[model samples]
Target: MKYVRKLPATDRQLSNQLIENGWKKIKEPRNFSLAVLFSLPFSYLLGSIILWLAYLLKPTLFEFLISDVLSISFSIDFKMLLYILFVFVYMLIHELIHAVFIPNFTKSKKIFFGLNGLFGFVFTTEPIKKERFLVISIMPFFLLSLVPVFLLNLLGFLNWYTLGLCLINAVGSCVDFLNMFLIAFQVKSGHTIINNGFETYYYPMQNIT
Candidate 1:
């Protein structure tokens, strides 16, 4: 999907607007190597912990459910695959929702896709004020992340793998939760004034236009 952000009179104008609201436009990293470096092992470790908890909670039920419903032979490896795939798809859609919503801002926007370890983000380069940003950041979690968990739980009652997948989906929203909280806090810091004193910072170089 594509998103566009209309640029203001000039980059300086946009940058000034951002700075007034507490946003400092920094140069894009030559590589997100450090981010990846921290995220890779982190993903594996977190994924492992989640899988272990699932195994402990319902070893027999989990094994049986995967074997019977998913029609996969019972094995630790297969269950691990199911866990990773479930989490990855859930998170992917969450980020995609952010991308789709950006077009409302401007005709120019930029999006970058890469793995931050096993996790990823779709960021926009456009400078958005705080009020609009609340919608952009919170919408995905509400519409894509949480709503899917409710639906997936219904399916989970019918299939064990689906239940496992739903669990992963719920947990995967932690990233969204953190993003929302950080943005909200930044908005509250009285930086970028929007309607009612809400402020949102912009990342120009990372914008997807």
Candidate 2:
């Protein structure tokens, strides 16, 4: 594996930390807006898979249970708008989950927070072990999407709002998923990882040609 520094096109606060800490940016910054757009298809794909599993496991219960939820029509009413606002607020909490796990994984409370170009981020300048970084990367998804959605679906209360929140948060987690994918599959196990907004930096733990 060859390592080289690449300048990232981002105005995030973490960029400075990366430079100061002598870590090389391995890739360009991924825009949150672009990530959101790219995640929609995957979100729908996940939804389809869940639905297919439900049908395969329990067709009658699944169809009868979700029928009302599916029948509920979308409307541009005040309540609908309020639900939208709630989802937006929940998104802040989503980013906060990423922040909260930083110290646990890195053993440092020196985390920086910022928002730029439709992205809210929590990052550290310090590099972390690949396993800990993977946990931090996927924590928000488990907290926001997997737990809530699974519980709601299990309790037979999977409404449009719950489903929408799940889908939206799942889509919002595009960057996390991408980072995890790269770390788990693309990057080797010994590399140290630092996430700066959309830019993921890798520090080689072993000599690479």
Best by lDDT: 2
Candidate 1 has an lDDT of 0.49
Among these predicted structures, which one has the highest TM-score? 2
Writing each residue's lDDT as its tens digit, candidate 2 over 83-102 gives 87888777878877876766
Q: Please, what are the lDDT tens digits per residue for candidate 1 over residues 1-209? A: 24223211234565566678555532221234443343344345434554554455446655655564565465668768877786688777776776667654334434444455566566555445455556666675466434444564445542455545544544554444444555565444323322111222443233322
**TM-scores for every predicted model:** 0.48, 0.66
Candidate 2 weakest lDDT stretch, 10 residues: 1-10
- Predicted candidate 1: what Cα RMSD to the true structure? 9.2
Candidate 2, pairs of clashing residues: none
